[model samples]
Target: MPDADSNPGNGDGREADVVPGNQGGRASRAAALSVRSLAVRSLAVRSLATLRAAVDRIIPADSWPAGWEGGVAEYLTVDPISADRDLAWAWPELISLAGRLDDEAHRAGADGFASLDPAAQDRILAVVAAGSGARSFDALRRVCWEGYYASSEGRHPAGLDMVGFRGVPEGVTPIEPEPLKTVAPAVVQAHYDAVIVGSGPGGGVAAQVLTAAGKHVLVVERAPYLRNDQIRGDHLHGKRNAVYWPTVGPGPGHPRVAQLPDGDRVLDGTDDASVYGLNADAVGGGTRIWQGMAWRFMPEDFSMRTLYGNPDGASLADWPVSYEEMEPYYTKAEWQLGVAGEEGGLTRRMPRSAGYPMPAMGTEPSRELLGAAADRLGWGWGPIPLAINSVPWDGRAACVRCAQCIGNTCPVNAKNGSQSTFLPRAIATGLCDLLPDAEVIEVRDGTGSAGVTIMADASTSPVELTVSADVVVVSAGAVETARLLLASGLGNDHVGRYLHDHRTATVLGESEHPVKPYIGPGHSVATLDHVHADTIPWGGGVIVDLMGLLPLTSAGQPAPGVPGWGAGHKEWMRGERANLFGVFAMGQEIPLPTSRVTLAAVKDRWGRPGAALRKDVHWTSQQVEDGMAVQGARWLDAAGITDIRRQGGPATASAAGEHSCGTARMGTSPENSATDPFGRVWGTSRVVACDSSLHPTNGSVNPTLTIVANAFRVAEHLVAEWPR
Candidate 1:
């Protein structure tokens, strides 16, 4: 196929050379001819073929469409080469195994490796599916299936629209006449009606709403704004900023904390040997660096206690409000955050007053394959609801489907994170002020209220600025917010307590067909079937995008017998990019009182106590494990995968921290919780804790949307009670 760059003028030239054959004369003929030429050239077709060949080598033939030569391959091939390479390198042994399959197929009288009879194919593939093959083949197949089907072609075939396909929504204009180019001083003493700490979904939205309401607002962020030029494509470079500290396990520079086997006293930020998956010190916080998924928790997710009662040794309580109270806020978040999708679908149970502000983003081959599999299984599969624009909504352009949606911010303002949705609008209102590079040191109690003391900049000279407000909202995330409360001596006893995160594990296997896994979103389009169950006590599971592993990062995966690096490693690495998928379990963790985050002996660059987390997920409940197994089996069955193996036992340690929540929880009573139902701190009448810190219990879905909705609810209360 001709490269996209090489064929820039091809379409235009074809259009100009068409002969008139209709009543409309030259114009009509030219249009028809152009379309015919485009069909004949089949640039898209060839690209798809290449992608199919790559994916087929990774997954089973049953996981893909009947004819693998369709648009799935093209969609997979359209992604960035860097992403493709990363997906390929995750499973080195899969590359060698695929080669063996080819040789075996040739010996078995097959036209090509993937074209063998189902029984014979399973026989050869079996070597890679079980035992040692389980790890390599499972990883390759999962990644490839996810990567290919989640692409534009894959999504369309599977019946989902592309996100950010057109222009931004009508009437919502871009912030006109940009703000002053000069950076504001690190500290400002100007009094405002509201002061929001942390510029994530919670704070950003608060700033916009309060500012628009004519209240003077100030947004304080610990990190500076990241520019487009600063973004890196290389995984190592991305890791420096994206990955949490103490990159290597049990190494020096790792934060230390005490841990308990059972639920007892917990500390925040110090436990969990894995790299925490939170946002960097950037303007948008986690929003600037997160997978673009936006899902509303099920109704049962909100009221955990009312439904299942409380779990033994866990603080699993019902949310103060039901999903009904937050329904409008969900809509508000979707429209404001620029979600793209069909409102009605079997998987989508929420009621919408209006359709998506924009159409859905295009799908890739991986999504299509999964969709097909789901259809075959008679299961529900819809476009993964996302905070991405199909046609530009709220002034940002639609996504080009660069295939790097997870872990990286978009260069174009396609992904609707805090920066794209709220910061700009907040700044434009002029009623709001943002102070970047300002880190709050402590929240000292004043005569009646509390005053925030902050270190303005990185300069040697210490400059302290105090701001007293009638109300203070801490949206600094679960870890930072808990640390701040502890540092301030406000709720030190409960500050770092009840640290929790999703207990994640991966199930992998390989396929007989090409899956072309690196084409679109980096996560699964279809969630696992065992997500909902009121009677059964279990955390839910979701299908993840194929695990895209870069060469340097691939060193982390020992994979039982595979060597770190060698000639065999390099050969395996070549095919590793497009061949893996993991059924990632974002299982709800049973919050133990012992899990906590406390002040570490070590300090950050600002001399403030760095958070030391002490987490204990070693006692993950059987319910979670059962749920994971159920979903894992279903996903493998749908994908027609063999030789499946589950990584990490029910009580094993995990490597993710993005879904961590509930260090400082919200409840009706202060003795049982850290904050009030309105998110206000227990003792303080004015200070409120927003962010995931206020989540009493972490649900199975990504917490950002819920966080935003709760923030809106908090903002509404504040606005209603404001001294008008």
Candidate 2:
């Protein structure tokens, strides 16, 4: 047979360059028809050949298409290895690994690895997998699997079909993309009444309020306003996919240094899904791809310090403003943003002034089974409060109930976020100037007016410009907010202290019968029985059904003791796809003073220092998760689910995760907090810290809803007391 690499158009090597994203592999089959289209020039000819050979052997043609045919070669050459800054260090190592394979083939009396027969290739790969290069080989194998399973653009059909995924229904037409109308840097004015230095929930709400009040507002965002399709991707490459870089997350040119629990400092780029602290960086922030679990902080959540009494060195503190003050705003957010849920079951635990704007989503088999389990366990269960539309209420269509919901853009524009709800309204008022792709580096506190120095297109063709604003609201998330304040010589010593997020525990279970979890929203039912349990002292978290897993995600997660790759892993995936069910408990993370965000020594693409994060979760958080996990296992067992596997403990490693907040907490005094009760920085009169950075303590659920409610409160306060 002719060498595969030498003759690119050979039988097996025909489909080389067409790397498609995962759209149930239905559309990917057409995409993976050619290899010459992809830019293989960057990779050495010999190295590319070896990669193809290695991936083909790893997932050889066994009734299904081989790994190389599923666009694994393109995935390896085009994505993280060549383009990702965080993984740039691994490029040379990967190249070396490829070279090692070729060298091994030479030792076996072959011209190169690609020239070897299938059996010979498998033997060489097996030898490497068990030898010194095991780790590197494993990494290569992981990427290959991701490529084959995830599909770059829904081009690989075999992987999706193997897992029984019926791609987006044939007749389902996606909602028309509503692109943001933004102000170009060249046309932006010098000053505005108020400038919000972030476009997340906090900044979006602030803009909506300020703009509605007829105040000229400038909303500066670090990321570009991505269209609906751009964010949708091929379903497998969104915010939830941990291994691959997400669509809404920060891309190349952005980097951060994270200090691990073992005290080792590692350089991480914005694209490093796990290490760099993955959060949505686009206009909507985390809300763009959030699961839409709209939850309000319980009344008792406002007084963690008063209730818990600072146990186990946790720096717990009560919010300066109580839930009573925030209740109206929470209502406003739920109604204005179009939340869908029933208030009947939640009236006692989560007291609301008014009912949800829309009714709860229809019950499905998964929810019914879980609700039954909760009933049997004597737990209080209810429809999960969602910011997704159950009816066509807010000019957007209702959700199509697609399997891929969380971490993905809603195909129907039903999932509400800052981008979908607030920013659009803010822009329509003609008073808001939304500038996307602009990074506000510093807020210069002038004697007369506040000046914000912004870098337009910081990633490519950087240009620095200083624009003035009467009030500068720093709503740039917890970490970035602290970094900006620290870098600009603003805020007190208390800035960047007491960082935390919801300590989450994911318990996966396998049911004997088909639960059909991949039918609608990833999660449907939830139990709040543990939110403030009497048994445990520190307060437990909400136990909800976990998001549905994509084929790639499932492929990456092998059950404990199962091999990560090879035929055994493949068989396990095929059998477990329909049976697997997940339960997630989001426990409260006790804020610790030691956990913080500061400036890193490394510079970004624009020559500015990146943020340095050191996070430490309290031991009490572990106890909370342990309690939740036990309840979760019981619930699963009640539902006749077995083979339970629990993951996530203490949240020490994942403290800087999606819900990271409280770095610049608000309180009564500057001695204990970075900002005042009204979210105003203690020293800076016109500058305010909005966003979850002002969260005194993270609650026991997803923080986006609370962040939205608080942003409404802060924006109202600013509007009432604008410096005239």
Candidate 3:
């Protein structure tokens, strides 16, 4: 290990007091603002005192492998009161709640939580952790473990030697924050051919294709260009870092209010438990962080209402464009992005026009292990189709086989996100100018063109900037794109309507040796047997294998009935290390009219209304999701993996806060849809949306590739329509 000064906890000269923050996927990145650092802020004394006194009890030191490590509970304290507070402040609130509960307890005679004796504190905390104060307590305990378990103190704990759980966050490659490539407002000579908002899959491809067609393209992205240092794969940073760029991003100040059955509630962007509607914002967008599984929707996906016959209460409709028209673009995206894997014919899957640019990655023990279970159950499982490179294709390097694939930025630069795949080419063409951190607040109709008003690099310096374009393509995912269109007063009738996502059911289990889940990419193998099967009563889901969990993430999540802290929790962590497996069912939900995104009444920091996401997934979709759960549980049972429990409840839209679509949907008319078949806003030829919002239904597949393909298709129209 490093010198004695590095570790200060153990008596024999280990790291001292567990480093304030964690050494997650980003070990080399400079540490900043530990929970201890929060103590220096306002009300810091009471928060720190309350946290220090309670962390050991919430996560007892003796109960853990180490004798005592004191930094974790402190990691739970942050002061967001000074912040704009639109971000996830579960930590600050949890710490503040600790102070609140302590005050209440103090009034009842015990001084405070910190001053109370161990037994009394435990009694109060247990009730709070399991009762009305549960949200805060549970959040506190989780972050406490997120900091502790990922630390040097928690990594080399007593019994961990047998489990061989060293905690994730292995290597560290330092990188500067990606500088904002700003577009000088004075440089534009005239109205550009196109302006694309949101540098995600849809916009990235559209910009590339349009620029290649010799059109001047100005691409405005809302998030800063995050350098490698900014994106660490650590559970603390990648999984639990809600303060900034949580998988759902623009970290703070981007509020997405939800209209619920009870009433409209403004969502804390950071809290995973509460926020149902989710959208990702970034220079690279969802492609930057998504688990790179690029499956194509079946031909039936284009005509869901026709094929399935629209169920009552669900606002399903036929796409104006058919699968045949989209086929060439799909072929182009796969080849251009250098997708891997082979011909897919898994159960109810669709036929493809061509094979992948490269063959699937060489087989590992996971396929065979999961395949054996599939064989026993008569299910068809195979190597999952992936955008990740098996061997170096194009100029990018091959995947380094780092298990920390999803959510974490690729240190080796192998994962083919649209940001890396298309934006580079678009920029290289010299005709495309990308302005990162430019939040497009409004897109209005200019004289024979479209006008976009934005705050250039809104993160650091917010300066109002407006630019005119011949065409405007808003691709800020489903929610944000809809918000922009509504704010711009285009597509006001249908904008921000029909929101949906792959209502998923996570089935976590433990395998023996054949499946070393913490090895390769996040998702490598999957079964498509359940999807759209006649045998199944409802629409089915895809079951893909995952790269399990880090010790920090897994430690916080005890088995179904086990207590989250103490000896039982520690022992449970040991048995679950390599044995753990992630087999999840991504079920399709019926998109309802009520499940929509509207402009919130309150304005955000940008002076535009925040996105108001309202979800009411149909009951039949709930049935399908429930059916998928049982089907996935059976798959795990057949594999002899134990501790199989369904992660989420019935009919709930989404938990991971992503893969949402259908809002601002495409169709034949203005009343029912926001955009035309070519992604053109109804009644407006030049204005369009190129994101998942154009999708009328999110088929039983990931939508990134499809979004890219559809964008390619739309860009062709924009090219042909432009004055050559």
Q: Tell me how far the alpha carbon of residue 281 in candidate 2 is from the true structure, in angstroms, after superposition.
A: 1.1
Backbone clashes under 3 angstroms, per model? 85, 19, 11
Off by over 4 Å in 3: 1-140, 150-190, 237-248, 268-277, 344-349, 510-516
Model 2, runs deviating above 4 Å: 1-57, 60-63, 73-125, 234-237, 242-245, 264-268, 446-448, 560-563, 648-651
Q: By descending lDDT, how would the candidates be arranged?
A: 2, 3, 1
TM-score of each: 0.69, 0.87, 0.82
- Residue runs of model 1 more than 4 Å from their true location after superposition: 1-183, 239-277, 344-347, 445-449, 459-462, 534-536, 544-564, 601-608, 618-622, 648-656
Global lDDT of each model? 0.56, 0.74, 0.66
- Tell me, by TM-score, which candidate is best: 2
Lowest summed-lDDT stretch of 10 residues in model 1?
1-10
lDDT of 1 at 262: 46
Give the alpha carbon lDDT tens digit for every residue of 315-422 in model 2: 999999899999999999898778999875455676668988899998887788998888788777888889998889778888788776666678888889988999
